[model samples]
Target chain A: MGGLTVMQALAAKLPGERFLYLGDTARLPYGTKSADTVRRYALQAAHALTDHGVKLVVIACNTASVGLPYLQEALAPMPVIGVIEPGAAAALAVAPNGPIGVIATEGTVKGGAYVRAIHAHSTAPVVQQACPLFVPMAEEGLTDGPIAEAVAHRYLDPLMARLPKPKVLVLGCTHYPALKGVITRVVGPEVTLVDSAAITANAVERLLDEKGLRATEKPGEHHFYCTDAPDRFARVGEIFFGNPIDPGAVEQVDLQ
Target chain B: MGGLTVMQALAAKLPGERFLYLGDTARLPYGTKSADTVRRYALQAAHALTDHGVKLVVIACNTASVGLPYLQEALAPMPVIGVIEPGAAAALAVAPNGPIGVIATEGTVKGGAYVRAIHAHSTAPVVQQACPLFVPMAEEGLTDGPIAEAVAHRYLDPLMARLPKPKVLVLGCTHYPALKGVITRVVGPEVTLVDSAAITANAVERLLDEKGLRATEKPGEHHFYCTDAPDRFARVGEIFFGNPIDPGAVEQVDLQ
Candidate 1:
């Protein structure tokens, strides 16, 4: 579900671009693993995608983006893009000066990637809040309503209590966008919610144009690959995409 | 933390027994995966455990135990023990008849292993509740608090509302023991909570004794292996084990 926003970006910004998505279903929630481990898995997956000969590699997952350097190095000469930088940019644009908030999974928050990214942007007070439950709730398709609201309130209250509370909150984890309504309600009217996927997609489009690698004018075709359980992947993909997915092009791959 | 209960049992009940525990830190939270994929991963892990020359394979994870038949079949001649049957037996002992509840990960409950096991004991009405968020909370060591209580109340409410509600509730997942206090408070009086790990360990003891495979009177040394991220595993193990652990003993093995 963390890739939903990225997928949406694929549709909106680069409608004619072909995408090859590989979901490491066997080793999901990479947000819970150590830095080195995340890098290794991300490299493995990037290699799998490269086997298909992709032109650009997008780390659609915020968790996997924790290992952006490894992914980039593993796929050298090919362009590598990650969600963190785009989200950090959006936060900087919105807050500009001080007091911005970041919400992500425990690993992503603990990895300090977004915090580091934002700090590199400006000295804006960045509060990293890990809403561990949001990922499961989003996967359950419990995106909106009282349950999401309650959970959001609990996680955001501490971040909100600071003097001159955050005016811009980055949906640091892609999954956070799924719970946007509830999260927006919890954070109240003052904060601008930055959508990382949209910003990252814009970046991708810019990269393609700059590299002069834009595809010929034709509708794009995309394929999906999962390390394990294509059926479960489809079920989850349907929830994230908010529609019934076509399973025809989906394949279950064993990443060595 | 899936094997925390089993490890606890190993230390207290079979102090003389040698154990080799494997936590598949890579493909974790097997609760959300398809049955076939779980079987594949569990088999790979079992093969790794067998390489240590251990006499037994205990599927310490309740969620992984859903694939026990696969593990037992793959590793025949060497015995394989799972937690579901033991937990069901404990539930039967507490309630004796109808109206029992079972709380586990979505995979374990949805697998219907507990229902099948409990049905063999008695034709009890088993309510299988998947408090998926509880595992993450427990891993974070947020066992008892307003957040835990609120989550517990939300998840336990429907089970509590059942007419002449379940008199006995089985803590189906090993991780459930960490949330025992909050769960107990939510389920309230008149309901008995059955711990699956304790019961499973007792079953393991009986099996070894019957097979004449019981170790001689000497405290035996043990080892721990993880498919990935041994450092993260050690950190989480400390939280579950409630003490600092020796990271030197934790080996990260790639079970290909």
Candidate 2:
């Protein structure tokens, strides 16, 4: 479902580029699962995309992004990108000095992908917090009320209280964007929020331009696929995608 | 993870019965998946349990309970029980009159298993509200405090305003038991809360006694298995199970 947000970003950035989205809804929420399990599922999903003959594969999900290296190795010669690097670079571009905050799911935080990615470029102090409830809250569409604000405060107050204070707060998880309103209020006005979806879209656009792989077509069609619950995906997915998902366009597929 | 609560209930009721528990942690939160996908996973899990030579099978999950009949048919002649029926029976036993309420995940509520199960015995009015956020809240250990109370009010206030007003509220999902305190406060003292875990345990106990299948052994061993993240299963699982899980006892298995 979070991938829908990235897909929308990609669509906005490169209008003529086609997209084939595969949501592992059946075994969703790779966020809380083990790294090994997430890696295996990510590989399987990437394989499905590779079989579809796409020019590049963007792992829109931050948790799944932890397996980018393994995915790049497994699908040799094919260009693959994950949200973490672009997000990390984007955060550093705005706040190159020190104290960057990252809020993602448990798996993403545990994987330390964002922290490592940021450190690879700069020695800025990175603070990470896992907001497990944000995904469900976002999905439930309780974006800004008392409950959302309360939960956000609970997760972010400590992160905000850290020494030096974070100038940039990375919305590392795609789902986090939905709760942006409450998150902004919780983090206050000083923090510049970085949305990985848009930044990753920018990264993909740059890569495509550099590689001369930009689409020449006037427009492109969007194809949606999931492992299960096409109806719910097409419905709730509209919240993330910011567009109505045609029920007929959503197809269900099984992955080994 | 919710199944762990049910497992704890079963262990309490049948101390002499050995158990083989499987947590489909890799593809958990079945609450949101389609019935077909959940049914397929349930069948696979049941097959794994059947191979272990268990005398009876209990579908501890309310969402997976939607496939109880199919599971019972698939594993014919093997006694099978689902939480929904037992939960509904218990709800009716307490509130024989009309206007009973049920709170569960989206899939479980959409399945209308509780409504059908309750109506199977009487013509009572079954009001159901899908509390999708409760599962994550419970898992995150935010079962109390202002946030919990706020979320409970958000979900329950509408149900409480119903025409007849539900006299008995059934906690249809296993994860719900953890939020019993907040939920009790929300529904007030006038409403009776039916815990599916305890009721299902009683049903299983009765079935075992009637069939002369109660274990003669003095004590029983509990084996915990999951598709992924044994460490997490032992850690977060303690919140649901109400007991510290042995890290060494947790084993990871693969499901087809």
Candidate 3:
């Protein structure tokens, strides 16, 4: 899910920076696994990305973010930034005085990455809620309608009632933004919702610029790789990127 | 999480089935991955299960149920059933007219397996809510307490207000029964909450009996395998199974 959106944003923002988006289609969705399991899969993905000549790696998935410490250790030499810190930093910056709500996958919420990161920089309390179903819906392109609205209410109602009602809500997982509309409505118009992808993309842009790793040369060729059916990846990637990605651009890579 | 439940349930009901529970610890959360990705991981897990000489296979995860058609085709010749059909069947039988609420991972909700299954058998209204965070909480042993209660209230309150209220609430995911107490309290006592494992076990027992596949000798033994760290699996499994599961019994499987 993060694979699709991050690539879309990158294409729009850094038109000249070559991007390689790999979906571990064979073993996608690391959010439900244990921390150890997430770390292993993340390392494998990082290795593949690095081998593809990615100067900087973005751990777009929140589950992967929780294991960024392990990924950083393995993917050292290349600068690696996870979606959590950038997001946490952004949430804090936006609502320094109010509570911040973080919605993510079960694994990410349990790891307490956002909570810790948010708490580290500011005294603003962090309220973490894991909306596990959001990923599947986003992936399935079921982000709108009564079903989506019902789900948004089911997840956001309780979080909205908490003391002071969080002014800033963090879309912790990469797949979450797809459900942002329904989520925003459920949480109400007053609360500010944060999508990590946007923040993370901005952070990536800054990191690349500061480190002199920004690709300034070509028209930025984009490559999409999945561990499973390449065609399916392209189909789903197209939905995520909000544009038709050429099937030819998507190919399969053996994660095993 | 299902690993521990399988082990405990096996220890009690069918000890003769020598246990080998693979955690897929490496690729733990099959729920968030795409249908194609889930099918591939589930197939890998089934291979491990068949390799262990198990006559029957249970795709314990709810997400797998949405993709059961694919799994049924892949694990052919061997009788394999996912938690969805049995669970949906159970809910339908109890509440032919009453509304049904389903809680599951994001993937399961997106698949609409429960809704389709229920609609196919009965006219009962189905309200499927995705409690994406529940899996991680249960795995983290945050099954009870202020934090868990708060989380459950946040997720269930909206579902509670949905309609005339559901008579039966299906705990669509295997990890959900752990949160039953809080879920029941939040949703209210009027609704009967369903646990997929119990329903699946009942279904499994019936199938085994009908086919004369029940272990007629000693009790069945369960072996748990995860693709991640054994210690982490065992620790989380122990919390959910309500017993001290020997960490040594959990062997890590390599997805690569």
| Model 1: per-residue Cα lDDT over B1-256, one tens digit each | 6686678776578877878888888768888877877888889889988987898888888888888888888899999999888888888887887699988888887799989988886887888798888888888777887778878887899989998899998888888888888898899977899887778889999999998988877555667788777777888897776656678888988877
The interface root mean square deviation of candidate 1 comes to 2.0
How well does candidate 3 match the true structure in TM-score terms?
A: 0.67
lDDT at B170, model 2? 95
Residue B180 CA displacement from its true place in model 1, Å: 1.4
Overall lDDT per candidate, in order of appearance: 0.83, 0.92, 0.76
Candidate 2, residues B141-228, lDDT tens digits: the string is 9899999999999999999999889999999999999999999999999999999888889999999999989997845568888999
Q: Which residues of candidate 1, in runs, are more than 4 Å off?
A: none
User: Which DockQ values do the candidates obtain, in the order shown?
Assistant: 0.59, 0.88, 0.18
Which candidate has the top score in lDDT?
2
* CAPRI tier for the interface of model 3: incorrect
Instruction: Going through the candidates in order, state the TM-score of chain A alone for each one.
Output: 0.96, 0.98, 0.96
| Candidate 2 local Cα displacement, residue A6, angstroms | 1.1
**lDDT per residue, candidate 3, A211-236, as tens digits?**
98777775556888777777767777
iRMS (Å) per candidate: 2.0, 0.7, 6.3
Clashing pairs in 1: none
Report residue A129 deviation for candidate 2 (angstroms).
Answer: 0.8
Over 4 Å off, model 3: B1-17, B23-216, B219-221, B229-251
- DockQ measured for candidate 1: 0.59
Listed per candidate, the RMSD to the true structure in angstroms reads: 2.1, 1.1, 7.3
The CA lDDT at B249 in model 1 is 81
Residue range A67-103, candidate 2, lDDT tens digits:
9999999998899999999999999998997699999
